[model samples]
Target: MALDIEQVRHVANLARLALSDEEIAVYQEQLSEILEYASSLAELDTEAIPPTAQVIALPGVTRDD
Candidate 1:
Protein backbone atom coordinates (compact mmCIF):
# COMPACT_ATOMS: atom_id res chain seq x y z
CA MET A 1 0.00 0.00 0.00
CA ALA A 2 1.44 3.29 -1.08
CA LEU A 3 0.95 6.31 1.18
CA ASP A 4 -0.12 9.54 -0.47
CA ILE A 5 1.43 12.94 0.22
CA GLU A 6 -1.78 14.15 1.83
CA GLN A 7 -1.76 11.23 4.25
CA VAL A 8 1.82 11.98 5.11
CA ARG A 9 0.94 15.60 5.64
CA HIS A 10 -1.93 14.63 7.91
CA VAL A 11 0.37 12.44 9.95
CA ALA A 12 2.85 15.26 10.25
CA ASN A 13 0.09 17.58 11.39
CA LEU A 14 -1.01 15.09 14.01
CA ALA A 15 2.56 14.69 15.17
CA ARG A 16 2.98 18.50 15.34
CA LEU A 17 5.87 18.25 12.93
CA ALA A 18 6.68 21.23 10.75
CA LEU A 19 8.19 19.29 7.89
CA SER A 20 9.45 21.00 4.79
CA ASP A 21 8.52 19.73 1.34
CA GLU A 22 11.80 17.79 1.07
CA GLU A 23 11.47 16.36 4.58
CA ILE A 24 7.90 15.33 3.93
CA ALA A 25 8.94 13.47 0.81
CA VAL A 26 11.76 11.71 2.63
CA TYR A 27 9.58 10.77 5.61
CA GLN A 28 6.75 9.59 3.36
CA GLU A 29 9.08 7.17 1.58
CA GLN A 30 10.65 5.92 4.79
CA LEU A 31 7.34 5.47 6.57
CA SER A 32 5.82 3.66 3.60
CA GLU A 33 8.77 1.27 3.41
CA ILE A 34 8.62 0.56 7.12
CA LEU A 35 4.89 -0.13 6.96
CA GLU A 36 5.38 -2.44 3.99
CA TYR A 37 8.08 -4.39 5.80
CA ALA A 38 5.88 -4.71 8.89
CA SER A 39 2.98 -5.87 6.71
CA SER A 40 5.15 -8.64 5.27
CA LEU A 41 5.71 -9.97 8.77
CA ALA A 42 1.97 -10.74 8.99
CA GLU A 43 2.50 -13.68 6.63
CA LEU A 44 4.32 -15.69 9.30
CA ASP A 45 2.64 -18.94 10.46
CA THR A 46 2.79 -19.28 14.23
CA GLU A 47 -0.02 -21.74 14.84
CA ALA A 48 2.25 -24.30 16.54
CA ILE A 49 4.43 -21.73 18.30
CA PRO A 50 4.29 -21.47 22.08
CA PRO A 51 4.05 -18.08 23.74
CA THR A 52 6.78 -17.17 26.21
CA ALA A 53 7.57 -14.20 28.47
CA GLN A 54 11.18 -14.04 27.43
CA VAL A 55 13.27 -15.01 24.42
CA ILE A 56 16.38 -16.08 26.38
CA ALA A 57 16.06 -19.36 28.29
CA LEU A 58 16.95 -18.76 31.93
CA PRO A 59 15.97 -20.20 35.30
CA GLY A 60 14.14 -18.05 37.80
CA VAL A 61 16.36 -16.27 40.31
CA THR A 62 16.11 -16.72 44.10
CA ARG A 63 17.72 -15.04 47.13
CA ASP A 64 18.26 -16.40 50.67
CA ASP A 65 19.53 -14.57 53.74
Candidate 2:
Protein backbone atom coordinates (compact mmCIF):
# COMPACT_ATOMS: atom_id res chain seq x y z
CA MET A 1 0.00 0.00 0.00
CA ALA A 2 1.28 3.43 -0.92
CA LEU A 3 1.24 6.17 1.69
CA ASP A 4 -0.29 9.54 0.98
CA ILE A 5 1.22 12.88 1.96
CA GLU A 6 -1.41 13.38 4.64
CA GLN A 7 -0.60 10.01 6.20
CA VAL A 8 3.08 10.88 6.20
CA ARG A 9 2.35 14.21 7.82
CA HIS A 10 0.23 12.54 10.50
CA VAL A 11 2.95 10.03 11.28
CA ALA A 12 5.55 12.74 11.45
CA ASN A 13 3.34 14.76 13.76
CA LEU A 14 2.86 11.76 16.02
CA ALA A 15 6.61 11.23 16.14
CA ARG A 16 7.18 14.96 16.87
CA LEU A 17 9.17 15.30 13.69
CA ALA A 18 9.69 18.60 11.94
CA LEU A 19 9.87 17.71 8.26
CA SER A 20 10.25 19.96 5.28
CA ASP A 21 8.21 19.37 2.12
CA GLU A 22 11.20 17.68 0.49
CA GLU A 23 11.82 15.48 3.49
CA ILE A 24 8.17 14.46 3.66
CA ALA A 25 8.18 13.57 0.00
CA VAL A 26 11.36 11.53 0.43
CA TYR A 27 10.10 9.69 3.51
CA GLN A 28 6.71 9.08 1.91
CA GLU A 29 8.31 7.14 -0.93
CA GLN A 30 10.78 5.33 1.31
CA LEU A 31 8.24 4.31 3.93
CA SER A 32 5.77 3.19 1.27
CA GLU A 33 8.43 1.01 -0.35
CA ILE A 34 9.28 -0.54 3.01
CA LEU A 35 5.64 -1.38 3.63
CA GLU A 36 5.32 -2.86 0.17
CA TYR A 37 8.36 -5.05 0.75
CA ALA A 38 6.95 -6.24 4.07
CA SER A 39 3.61 -6.95 2.38
CA SER A 40 5.42 -9.12 -0.15
CA LEU A 41 7.13 -10.97 2.69
CA ALA A 42 3.73 -11.62 4.28
CA GLU A 43 2.76 -13.53 1.14
CA LEU A 44 5.54 -16.08 1.73
CA ASP A 45 4.66 -19.64 2.81
CA THR A 46 6.36 -20.62 6.04
CA GLU A 47 3.95 -23.13 7.47
CA ALA A 48 6.48 -25.97 7.32
CA ILE A 49 9.15 -23.95 9.08
CA PRO A 50 9.57 -24.40 12.82
CA PRO A 51 9.52 -21.38 15.13
CA THR A 52 12.92 -20.62 16.64
CA ALA A 53 14.17 -18.23 19.33
CA GLN A 54 17.79 -18.43 18.26
CA VAL A 55 19.65 -19.68 15.19
CA ILE A 56 22.86 -20.55 17.12
CA ALA A 57 23.48 -22.30 20.45
CA LEU A 58 24.43 -20.16 23.45
CA PRO A 59 25.84 -21.23 26.78
CA GLY A 60 24.20 -20.23 30.06
CA VAL A 61 25.67 -17.08 31.58
CA THR A 62 24.11 -17.09 35.06
CA ARG A 63 25.64 -18.84 38.06
CA ASP A 64 23.61 -21.10 40.43
CA ASP A 65 21.17 -19.02 42.44
Candidate 3:
Protein backbone atom coordinates (compact mmCIF):
# COMPACT_ATOMS: atom_id res chain seq x y z
CA MET A 1 0.00 0.00 0.00
CA ALA A 2 1.17 3.49 -0.87
CA LEU A 3 1.49 6.15 1.80
CA ASP A 4 -0.23 9.43 1.10
CA ILE A 5 1.01 12.87 2.14
CA GLU A 6 -2.04 13.32 4.33
CA GLN A 7 -1.20 10.17 6.21
CA VAL A 8 2.34 11.42 6.70
CA ARG A 9 1.04 14.71 7.98
CA HIS A 10 -1.24 12.92 10.41
CA VAL A 11 1.60 10.78 11.68
CA ALA A 12 3.82 13.80 12.11
CA ASN A 13 1.11 15.56 14.04
CA LEU A 14 0.63 12.53 16.29
CA ALA A 15 4.40 12.31 16.85
CA ARG A 16 4.54 16.00 17.78
CA LEU A 17 6.86 16.61 14.89
CA ALA A 18 7.26 20.11 13.52
CA LEU A 19 8.43 19.40 10.02
CA SER A 20 9.13 21.88 7.29
CA ASP A 21 7.61 21.38 3.88
CA GLU A 22 10.85 19.88 2.55
CA GLU A 23 11.28 17.62 5.57
CA ILE A 24 7.74 16.37 5.31
CA ALA A 25 8.22 15.56 1.63
CA VAL A 26 11.44 13.70 2.31
CA TYR A 27 9.94 11.72 5.18
CA GLN A 28 6.91 10.86 3.09
CA GLU A 29 9.11 9.19 0.49
CA GLN A 30 11.42 7.50 2.99
CA LEU A 31 8.57 6.20 5.11
CA SER A 32 6.76 4.87 2.07
CA GLU A 33 9.83 2.96 0.95
CA ILE A 34 10.32 1.52 4.42
CA LEU A 35 6.74 0.32 4.57
CA GLU A 36 7.02 -1.22 1.10
CA TYR A 37 10.14 -3.13 2.08
CA ALA A 38 8.46 -4.37 5.24
CA SER A 39 5.52 -5.58 3.20
CA SER A 40 7.86 -7.61 1.00
CA LEU A 41 9.23 -9.38 4.07
CA ALA A 42 5.79 -10.88 4.71
CA GLU A 43 6.19 -13.17 1.67
CA LEU A 44 9.05 -15.17 3.19
CA ASP A 45 8.49 -18.75 4.35
CA THR A 46 9.64 -19.36 7.93
CA GLU A 47 7.81 -22.56 8.84
CA ALA A 48 11.03 -24.41 9.69
CA ILE A 49 12.68 -21.55 11.53
CA PRO A 50 12.56 -21.49 15.31
CA PRO A 51 11.47 -18.35 17.10
CA THR A 52 14.18 -16.54 19.03
CA ALA A 53 14.09 -13.81 21.63
CA GLN A 54 17.59 -12.60 20.84
CA VAL A 55 19.92 -12.56 17.86
CA ILE A 56 23.14 -13.37 19.79
CA ALA A 57 23.95 -16.63 21.62
CA LEU A 58 25.11 -16.41 25.24
CA PRO A 59 25.24 -18.68 28.26
CA GLY A 60 23.18 -17.83 31.31
CA VAL A 61 25.10 -15.82 33.91
CA THR A 62 25.53 -17.28 37.41
CA ARG A 63 27.37 -16.41 40.62
CA ASP A 64 30.67 -18.26 41.20
CA ASP A 65 30.61 -21.15 43.71
Candidate 4:
Protein backbone atom coordinates (compact mmCIF):
# COMPACT_ATOMS: atom_id res chain seq x y z
CA MET A 1 0.00 0.00 0.00
CA ALA A 2 2.77 2.39 -0.83
CA LEU A 3 1.54 5.90 -1.50
CA ASP A 4 2.55 6.99 -4.97
CA ILE A 5 3.58 10.42 -6.21
CA GLU A 6 0.46 10.77 -8.37
CA GLN A 7 -1.85 10.40 -5.38
CA VAL A 8 0.07 13.02 -3.44
CA ARG A 9 0.02 15.34 -6.41
CA HIS A 10 -3.75 14.92 -6.73
CA VAL A 11 -4.31 15.69 -3.07
CA ALA A 12 -2.14 18.78 -3.34
CA ASN A 13 -4.06 19.89 -6.37
CA LEU A 14 -7.39 19.49 -4.57
CA ALA A 15 -6.06 21.59 -1.68
CA ARG A 16 -4.88 24.28 -4.13
CA LEU A 17 -1.28 23.63 -3.15
CA ALA A 18 1.70 24.12 -5.42
CA LEU A 19 4.15 21.46 -4.35
CA SER A 20 7.26 20.50 -6.26
CA ASP A 21 8.18 16.93 -7.18
CA GLU A 22 10.47 16.56 -4.15
CA GLU A 23 7.79 17.71 -1.72
CA ILE A 24 5.26 15.35 -3.23
CA ALA A 25 7.56 12.38 -2.73
CA VAL A 26 8.17 13.31 0.90
CA TYR A 27 4.46 13.68 1.65
CA GLN A 28 3.76 10.37 -0.04
CA GLU A 29 5.98 8.47 2.40
CA GLN A 30 4.61 10.33 5.41
CA LEU A 31 0.97 9.84 4.47
CA SER A 32 1.54 6.17 3.70
CA GLU A 33 3.06 5.60 7.14
CA ILE A 34 0.08 7.28 8.79
CA LEU A 35 -2.43 5.13 6.93
CA GLU A 36 -0.48 1.96 7.71
CA TYR A 37 -0.43 2.78 11.41
CA ALA A 38 -4.19 3.35 11.42
CA SER A 39 -4.68 0.06 9.61
CA SER A 40 -2.62 -1.79 12.25
CA LEU A 41 -4.66 -0.29 15.06
CA ALA A 42 -7.85 -1.58 13.41
CA GLU A 43 -6.53 -5.14 13.83
CA LEU A 44 -6.29 -4.92 17.62
CA ASP A 45 -8.44 -7.29 19.70
CA THR A 46 -10.68 -5.45 22.17
CA GLU A 47 -13.98 -7.27 22.03
CA ALA A 48 -14.23 -7.90 25.80
CA ILE A 49 -13.42 -4.30 26.74
CA PRO A 50 -16.12 -1.79 27.54
CA PRO A 51 -16.49 1.35 25.43
CA THR A 52 -15.60 4.75 26.84
CA ALA A 53 -16.57 8.19 25.67
CA GLN A 54 -13.28 9.99 26.35
CA VAL A 55 -9.60 9.10 26.39
CA ILE A 56 -8.59 11.94 28.70
CA ALA A 57 -10.11 13.04 32.04
CA LEU A 58 -12.97 15.39 31.32
CA PRO A 59 -15.83 16.92 33.29
CA GLY A 60 -18.30 14.08 32.63
CA VAL A 61 -16.96 11.73 29.96
CA THR A 62 -15.42 8.42 31.07
CA ARG A 63 -11.64 8.06 31.19
CA ASP A 64 -9.99 5.16 29.36
CA ASP A 65 -6.86 5.12 31.50
Q: How close is candidate 4 to the true structure, as a TM-score?
A: 0.76
Model 2: per-residue lDDT, tens digit, 9-37?
Answer: 99999999999999999999999999999
Candidate 3 residue-wise lDDT, 1-65, digit = tens: 57888999999999999998898899989999999999999989999999999999889798778
| CA lDDT for candidate 4 | 0.89
For model 1, the superposed segments whose C-alpha errors exceed 4 Å read 53-65
Cα deviation of 39, candidate 4, in Å:
0.7
- Candidate 1 per-residue C-alpha lDDT over 19-52 given as tens digits, one digit per residue, 9 for 90 to 100: 9999999988999999899888988898899999
Where does the lowest 10-residue lDDT sum fall in candidate 1? 56-65
Top lDDT hit: 2
RMSD of each: 2.4, 1.2, 1.8, 6.0
Kindly report which residue pairs in candidate 4 clash with one another.
none
Q: Could you tell me the TM-score of candidate 3?
A: 0.79
Listed per model in order, the count of residue pairs whose N, CA or C atoms clash below 3 Å is 0, 0, 0, 0
TM-scores vs. true structure, each candidate: 0.76, 0.88, 0.79, 0.76
lDDT at position 14, candidate 1: 100
Better of 2 and 3 by lDDT: 2
Q: What's model 2's overall lDDT? A: 0.99
